[model samples]
Target chain A: MLDVKAEAAEHSGAGAPGEEAPPLVVEGLGHAFGERQALRNVSFRLNRGDRTMLLGLNGAGKTTLFSLITRLYNHRSGSIRIFGFEIKDKPSEALARLGVVFQLATLDLELSVAQNLLYHAALHGLPRREAAVRLKREIERVGLTDRLREHARTLSGGQRRRVEIARALVHQPKLLLLDEPTVGLDVASRQFLLDHVRMLCNEGGIAALWATHLIDEVDSGARVIVLHHGQILAEGPVPEVIRRANASSMREAFDKLTGERSE
Target chain B: MRPIHYARCLRGIIWREALRFINQRGRFLAALVRPLVWLLIFATGFRFVLGVSIIPPYQTYIPYQVYIAPGLIGMILMFQGMQSSLSMVWDRETGSMRTLLVSPLPRWYLLTSKLIAAVIVSVLQAYVFLFIAYFWGVHPPRLGYLTVLPALILAGMMLSGLGLFLSSVIRQLENFAGVMNFVIFPMFFASSALYPLWTVKQANLKLYYICMANPFTHAVELIRFALYEKFNLEAFAVVGGSLVIFMTLAILGYDPGRGLIARRAGTE
Candidate 1:
């Protein structure tokens, strides 16, 4: 993949130039798991072509936020809009424009790769011929065209993740949400996956929200949202977040902002 | 999503379920063995012990294996319902159910499709058992084979619905085997699946009443009568009524807001 950091820097202004709506807008989002508040008063906007890193440590409510955005869980305390469509009120329309790669691999291990993709396309109500076309294009881009007939369980962890990414893109979503997608990957696989996703945002003009605790995943030009203890501590460009925390590096800024050492 | 979309989704679910069923050879053999054992082994020993009167479906004195064939078919489907519950638990734990639930389609549609898939598999098992029974000397009328399909379908729906209801209540997969044994054995033994109701009443009036009240008894009677091309309105009403009730309950149990699934996930 090409250098996404350079591409994002070239297209620095990720959102529309004074356009009416960005790709995603979340306002006053609050959620709770029973008595425990997983998220509170959290809000952010992801613009078209922007790569936003949802930075937080373990137990920082990152998964909860992703779950709410993806409609895995519903919240009444706040509102979320994707492409100007409210999620709760117009879920089908909102979700139609969104693609998600969960932390866990959701593929049916018993199924072949092509079968898995076809099944997802059917769920999205895509016609078989159109699904086949999209499957070809997406897998080709991910360099997995030859592995299409292989069973999902036989693939390496990174290869399966790539297939998942390709599967998410089969319907051509405008906004993508990934929750700790690189948790179990090796170093090379992590870089490859991150770069591939970043390249998708840069080339396809698709907005992305990548959630992770690792600071290294955040590019200098990417938007950063520092979440801690179920709340947003800071949100801005990488350097600005660092400057606001009076820290010299992203690691120091995360430490000072979250008030916890990154292990 | 349009009507075509719903059709495609249903097709996809059923296709996946059918493929899974076909791949599990052990499940097929186990389903076959359980009912056959009741016929070939247990029925031979107990045939003389329990005297069966001339039932409507039976013109004259019928051997125990011939009498118990339809009941054993019901038993096969009942166990199939439990098997469906096990798969549901596995889906939830493995997170594939999350994928199904996230679809734009309504939850009721997704659940109904799953129930239908289970019923189809159960009916297939019933036919397979019926086929083998012919060779084992437990033969029904030639036309009885044709009538058994509808009976098996209805019985499968009721039993699968009951299984869905149990799955909604059972939280974990590890705990399901004991629950399945508890449910299947009692449902089979307490009903007319093994012996005739009159014989039970002769032995004990209270036990006979209990057997009379058991829905499994009605299920067996519905199949048994249908196997001989006979219609039992009372059996039909009970089985059909119980099917509707259990199906509605199962659908409600899968509802995300107040359902057991939501409650368990929320607590987690």
Candidate 2:
């Protein structure tokens, strides 16, 4: 929808040799809430241009892991690095390259769509002129240019999610993290979002980690991390995981790996 | 991050606060009405019962309405401070706080910017109250109008610090109503807000001691003296010291690694 080719060309030859570290890397990440462990020894990596799906059920610690990696909750037992910058020691550097679409709606309902996008851009330290340009471009790409002046409350669920996706891209982050972004969307909206994110990874060279519990959302060739009970049960391509789980379909593989039947 | 980036961040936060205030027309009306009701009805009824005396800020005996104007200003700031904290709790529940916390800026800077924005809104409300009280036959010295600003800022910051600390400890929105009754009412009533501290001393010694120990009492005295273009060194010292303590505790309370947030990350 955007000038993806031009933007991709701009970033194509930027990184030097040996400077292209994976967009994200988590090592032995563990987190807890008092006596309850939320995430334990979770590890993963996302290379440039990779669109990895982090598949987990409710309370499977997917949100907990995202919180730790996003630095919303501090991790005590492990480390998270973004583009070679450790989150604990170099938070600013690490967070600057991250774009997140939280599970809950975070838009200020009183503020217009453009205002919300501009506020996010300012938070990421974008210059006023640059922020305005990106705000316009991103809103246009999301097909909401005419609705820019409308308050977030006026938009439908799908439109709000699209606006959020556009907001996340305003700062041009290197790593995008979405936690159940399509939870309540319609069939078309869900497909649109999934395709848009995949396009970003394929054309714009941005790496993404999409967290979802829906089994049908995963593509057969894409890398996936199946999490269960605060631990990753499987990691690899879909076919490899299904085969390793001694199942014929992704749904069966997930049920077998998590030791639960799908209702 | 560059200094310019920090400035941009501050501007954005302040702008959002201003926009939210403008959008919430009912909140602004309520902020003004709460103080006005006290100035108009409560003070009018108490005028006959309460006798005025010559205080440091008062050269001669003043009417009950004039005597209570500064207290009402302090009331505006305190109520607004608490109101802002309520919004913070709401923000956390609604998930907007997560967006703010995940920003690249340091947590301290973000929290401070929030405090400063709240203070600006409260100060604006205070000035509007002062303006309305002017037509109601209550007038401080002309210079008092100009001098009361810094005093309001200091008092606003202190009250907001208390508010921020409360918001960090508060778990649910339902608990905030309990806090308003326990924390707000006691602080307002036990202080020298309604009557002079000397009057409280004459009536009950124990109440006078509690009033003296209350930070809200110093905040009231600070505003009371500053509105008359005079300085109260004691009130100034107490308010400033309390501000430091409250702000430090609030910053720690919101800290992710060590404070209450770390203990219970469920709500935050």
Candidate 3:
């Protein structure tokens, strides 16, 4: 086993009493694929128990940033700390507290929904009894209790998304990262996933960073970080970013921030 | 992660692989068909023409079927290795590999677990081939069946490791079929899988050296000796060394820093 105590000390000194660290803190993060830069100087912080929308168009580096945060790709110039644990220096410790729902469908189409969740639970090192309990709870949250025995391929697009979210939550991660969670979902399914995540923030008290291209998915009160062309263009609450850009709507604001002159 | 967590993760991956294999009835059948065809058709045709010498593992001249049975076993495993690697490409294209990568488990554990799973399937296929070959009159000495288990496992590991390395290098699933044709046939035909290395030396010295140098040749030799309840130290060293080397390359190929999978994220 890795020396957890040494890793904790190496990344961040002991915290003061009653001072809880933010869920995520990233700074000066940059990544390039050969000569083409995918992300440059991206920085952000997510408060505990808050939902943040990562708004960007396709090819805007949302997936790249998520890949770095999830440790799927290492950034060349940047730092990502999850709950005060550096991603590069202490990946296991940092990743243990994180849950992710990727943009692509990751479920085993051949396996039952319950089986898929149980497998994921085992991957997280949850024992059988504990995994079963968590699995049932999360499945209920996603409203797929009856479909548990069905193959994932038999489910609708939204149902599969819910199952994925449930699978991500079964391990009780402190932070959830969803990359374009609603890309292929119908209107109702998209709303269902968003509402469920909101409930998780409010009730379960889990912090989340939801990535999406559609601007309407960004609730007014939610913290918004706009990424365009591999760089952060604007970050703050929705109203503030819009007012700063002198745009009336979030769409217009995004256009202006990305330098897309309105015709 | 604790040792227990690592064990749990490995178990999950292996179980999932087992589940996938069980569901793919066509793949299992295809795995058996290729080796069986070679054992029945090719070996039968060559049985009259080729005469195996009194190799250390063999006390007398052996029939071509008996000679090539172990080679066919090697063929089965080589195909299995490539088959598993092909699935790796499919998993990447389908995004299941990403789910696995994001896990808190070390990348080495995740990848090794995958390789072990492929080894398990290949080993199972080898036994099935052995069972069929037994009834087909290619029986080794009485103890050969029992003795071949370790040989199959060792050979399976080496071949699966090679497959994992190939999966890490081959970028596209469509391209893998072509690569597999180039790899599986060459590794199977260039080695002692069909004829003795001495026979190749008799016919062509250069082809003999290439056969002797091929790791699949060593794998077949390892199994060939083990099936006769004998041992071949040279074959053991070659297969073992190749396992370590290929496994290392595969593990490095999966590292997020410089591996092929890292480039996949940007392209996607």
Alpha carbon lDDT of each predicted model: 0.81, 0.85, 0.84
Candidate 3 lDDT, A1-263, residue by residue in tens: 12343344335532421114567888899998877898999988876667899988888888889988998867798788887778888888788889999888889897889889888987877787889999999999889999999988899989999999999988888789999999878999999998999989877767899998898898887789998888999999888998999999888998888876332
Ranking of all predicted structures according to lDDT, beginning with the best and ending with the worst? 2, 3, 1
TM-score of chain B of each: 0.94, 0.95, 0.93
Which one wins on DockQ? Answer: 2
1 or 2: which has the higher TM-score?
Answer: 2
Off by over 4 Å in 1: A1-21, B92-94, B202-210
Q: Write the per-residue lDDT of candidate 1 for residues A84-163, one digit (tens) a residue.
A: 77777767777777888888788888788888888888777788899999998988888889999988888989988888
Docking class of 2: medium
Instruction: Give lDDT: candidate 1, residue B1.
Output: 73
RMSD of each: 4.3, 3.6, 4.2
Model 2 spans > 4 angstroms off: A1-19, B92-94, B172-175, B266-268
TM-scores of chain A, one for each prediction: 0.91, 0.91, 0.91
Q: On residues B116-162, what C-alpha lDDT tens digit does candidate 1 reach at each position?
A: 88889888888889988888788789999999889888988888888
**Who is ahead in lDDT, 1 or 3?**
3
Worst 10 residues of 2 chain B by lDDT: B85-94
DockQ of each: 0.39, 0.56, 0.54
Give the winner by TM-score.
Answer: 2
